[model samples]
Target: MNTQDAGPLLEIRRLTTRFQTQNGALNAADDVSLMVGKAETVGVVGESGCGKSVTSLSVLRLVPSPGKIEAGSILFDGEDLLSKTSRQMEGIRGKDISMIFQEPMTSLNPVYTVGKQVAEALLVHNPALGRKRARDQAIEMFGHVGISEPKSRFDTYPHQLSGGLRQRAMIAMALICRPKLLIADEPTTALDVTIEAQILRLMKKLQNETGTSILLISHNLSVIAETCDRVYVMYSGRIVEESDVFDLFDRTLHPYTSGLLASIPRKNSAIEPGKPLHSIPGGVPDMTRLPCGCKFAPRCEEVMEICCREEPTLADAGGGHCVRCWKFLGRKAVKV
Candidate 1:
């Protein structure tokens, strides 16, 4: 389904999350805006410290201590999440929206059995289900998420499970309540290739079955390409480009996006023997002391004097593709 034609399930506008560090206030997410259509899988891709995780945390109003959402709105199902009271948010989270955090080992409680944790999620939103029913449902979900011998595995502690099973348990916890939206932050991090592929496929299958919209955050472009319908390319603390998966790869406009694509190792393609893989020069700038103009200007190979002098707004460059770059400033929007 075309996201433009369908109403958005979640819409974030001008979100700015700030952290008060000893050095200065840092904008972890700056004017970040994106949308997830119903049942659509959207991806946020960028290197570490680029604010991808912070943006997701902001949406759930779970930004860590000393970090606050200074501005912007997060609209979910036409309701402003930012305006909701903590009590109201408690009602919304897990039932309406759930997140599978980056690391299962860290996110999952070591003290609790994986089954009990997943069951608790259901119990939180549906107390009437009772412990017996909740346990049954959690086990069913574990089976659905591909856990072998769900009944036995459900009783195991997070430390007892392998990384893949821990991840599956996390997914079961997030999906048990059948939330409308699932925010998966680096869900496959540290998994083997086979496990990663399995996890991605399991998510896709579950999403299809439940019709849940997913906002998948990852630095892996290959993962994004395999799963997401649309892509949002984040930089220092801002979205540098937004496009459908096909166009983002086929007609990459932003220099940073191009650099990222170039960095990916291509299989079955001719390559010079012993050639070094392409890498974007320079690390993400310190948020507190970002460059005066474009955050990426210092590393951008096609940087212009104007690029270094003025920050560019995210402007449409046709076919629903938006880019924040000096080069595409005056280009007329063209429908594909």
Candidate 2:
């Protein structure tokens, strides 16, 4: 894919997802939009309950019961995914877009072998394929994901594999059909450091080989920095900031983005014991009763009166960067 000519494989526009709760239906993902260009990686980062997971589920139209995509469009290959029927979605699910979930232990079935699980993915997409061919392809996918002696492993059950191997199996299963877009939601949360690095590298390798675009959802800034070409910072169901990875971390325009970077300790930071610890302060606002001004205003140290009176709009700051903040609304930051 040429850098300049690449078009978005998946484009989310003004997508809003609401879930029914005890209080009322709340926007788990509110008017969030971003693009994943061909062979590109887009990272969605934020704390837990900040709509990171909800956004991905909405894109895949897999929102849990009691949740609905209230408005907006999800375009894949220039078609509206939100309007598709369940049968229509089935055709696109694995053949065009696939997802690797957070935990393989819970995501995988205990009753089936690792090979059977991966083979099932293929069988679901291509029913014409016989079980024998599906089994062979499953073994082949295991090798593609770096499992040694894939044929032997094919007969092994998920319980027999280690945590890293199970994750590998999950990745293999997800990519068996070589889908155009891959949505990986915290795919490495359960692995150890070494295995996590391996899985990341494996995904990168396969992506380059197959020209697959990826949407990686994670809380680890370092992981996002290493893999994603672009990123979105979400807060209280809204995308607060978005830009190229280098510009995002180096010259963040939103206060929430700045606080996220500040929370991560540098290698040379001086360590002091219990010196009033550092954090953004305040819990995630109640979804049903979010502040009228800014979702993050209650926790922002630099909050001003205007920040509490009006909601900020995502506007162009410069160089394809977008931020929602009163300070930068309708004008670029006059940097000195």
In terms of lDDT, the poorest run of 10 residues in model 1 is: 327-336
Error of 1 at 184 (Å): 0.6
- The lowest-lDDT stretch of 10 consecutive residues in candidate 2 is 1-10
| Candidate 1: residue pairs that collide | none
What are the runs in model 2 whose C-alpha is more than 4 Å off? 1-6, 272-277, 330-336
Q: Tell me, by TM-score, which candidate is best.
A: 1
Q: Supply the TM-score for candidate 1.
A: 0.95
Candidate 1 lDDT over residue span 1-336, tens digit each: 112434799999999999999999999999999999999999999999999999998989999999999999998987789998999999988888999876896668999999999999899899998999999999999989999899999889999989898999999988998898999999998899899999999999999998999999999898999999999999988999999999999999999999989888889667788999889998889889999888999999998888889899999878999999987783443322
Alpha carbon deviation, residue 245, candidate 2 (Å): 0.3
Misplaced by over 4 Å in model 1 are 1-6, 330-336
Instruction: Please write out the lDDT profile of model 2 over residues 37-58, one tens digit for every residue.
Output: 9899999998889899989998
